[model samples]
Target: MSDMTIGKVAQAVGVGVETIRFYERRGLIEQPLRPKSGGYRVYPDETVQRVQFIRRAQHLGFSLREIAELLSLRASHGTDAIEVRQRATAKLQDVDHKIERLRHIRRGLMALLDRCPGQGPLRCCSIIDALEHDQRLASEPAERKEPDMQTVRLTIKGMHCDGCAEIVRHVLEQQPGVKGCSVSHENGEAKVAVDTSQTSGERLAEAVQGAGYSASLVTEAG
Candidate 1:
């Protein structure tokens, strides 16, 4: 068997070196064999293909643990129909759930797009008007006037317009420590200022997603 180093495997697979380390830590891949000759850890050239498999599975929404399970399944039963059927059934259910959600949203949008009042821009958009109402709660004088200077930026997706941006910002601003939050429709970025004493990134992300958006911590640089 041709020996390969971690860097060689990562290079061959088109992934960063750290990604291989993460796969090792996650138990999704095997560790390299460190020979007694001390020529640095050497892996089988097959590791490149394995890393490629992992990246493809991750894109398909398989978690690392699930990928490990899949590897185990493949090792034990390459042609077992029963186990394959069960895995397909579970994955199908996941797909069905997503499809159902999409269908519901499609129906709602059809109504909104067709029933849009022809009065004018401000008066015609039912979506924006509803979101504006949601943010009205923040205008209350009793709320905290200001929050600390700590800023968090969440990388978000699924925002198609200013309405979506407004909706996320309106929802995030309601959190206790969050004095203000704003989403850029152009870039799918959200800038927020919060007081650590009241709310955290977890809290803010939950709040934003709860309203209707996808978000996650991409970075936290000052």
Candidate 2:
């Protein structure tokens, strides 16, 4: 490959000229040498391939700094497999976390939609009421007290919004043995007071799943 102009390299990589210049400024890609005759800035053919590499990395969620490190590794002839594998592993973990969070968000939206009548007045809309409050607006006072109440900490998943907390609370409170429930979507936790003799933590988790969410026992008071 011989000398190529910056515009030519950008066109070859399907990127704008400014993008290449920006990468150069970020030290992600090298700037070509200035022409001795002062015609136009020309780059080597290899720069096109490097720009493509950077763009591909960006598409995969690598920050410019990480891409720079990757480029450095690419340039080094003695790059170790372990270093590359570690970066790949870390990226995979990040992607998995993101997928989990999105799944939670989707489930919360579905739960809300399931409660929505979609044809009623805004005041009667269950989804609207859920969003406007942290707890269920229709909760009734406990009719009776339990002789032996247990406190359980549940790790609640599929709670990506404040409304999700409300939904979880509503689900648990509707159960026969449940005294009350408090939930925090941000922390993905629900603390419930229940009649231990009548209901178990697994039952509570099952109820949460019935409400279109996930729950697991973190701790239970005997």
Candidate 3:
């Protein structure tokens, strides 16, 4: 096929012009050199196929980074199919894990809904009470106890936004024996206080991981 201008490439690929530039910036696609005559840069027909491949991979839940790796594998000579298969298998496992986490969230929401009368005043609403109780527990200090109290610092990954930090905080605070937690998406960390007799640092990390983010105990102190 003949080479086409950037506009034609975008039109043919069903994406905006900026999107093509974005792909170039992300290293997912290469931008052709400008013509010596000072004309627009042309794109080869292969660019269309590559952009389509990226879109299809995204639809299948693969992130841009993963798609780049797939493209690299495709461009490599003598690459085995196993490499591609392994990536797909790993992606499938991630999807399954997210599905399970969503199921848990749905069940918890349903339980709250079942307990709610749906028409009561806000103060007496089961849903409101449940949410308020969590907020209070996360902020309030735990009562004095005989058991030793410990604080653990956790480094987390895969949190992309503020909402992710909130989810991690909720998961941490809901754990048994947890007194409070502070989570920050920017720093990708969580500081949790718990009663050592009821829960351990490892268990807290596992709880965060179960919520779909990677977590590891960084430090623990009594």
Best TM-score among the predictions, by candidate number = 3
Best by lDDT: 3
What lDDT tens digits, residue by residue, belong to model 3 across residues 63-101?
999999999999999665546755676676578777866
Tell me the deviation in Å of residue 135 in model 2.
5.1
Ranking by TM-score: 3, 2, 1
- Compose the digit string of candidate 1's lDDT tens values, residues 1-222: 478888888888888889999999998889967889888798887787788888997887677887887778777844343444344445555666677666666766665566567568786577676556653212222323333346677878889999999888888878886655667879888877666667788788888788778888656453
Which 10-residue window in model 3 sums to the lowest lDDT?
A: 135-144
Task: Output the better candidate (1/2) by TM-score.
Answer: 2
The Cα local distance difference test for each model comes to 0.73, 0.79, 0.82
Candidate 1 lDDT (Cα, 0 to 1) = 0.73
- Candidate 1: give the clashing pairs: none
| Model 2 lDDT tens row, 48-102 | 8888899999999888998899989888997654455456555655677777666
Clashing residue pairs in candidate 3 are: none
TM-score, per-candidate, Cα-based: 0.49, 0.58, 0.59
Higher-ranked by lDDT: 2 or 3: 3
Error of 1 at 122 (Å): 3.8
Q: Name the regions of candidate 1 deviating beyond 4 angstroms.
A: 33-39, 77-79, 117-124, 132-222
Indicate the TM-score of model 2: 0.58
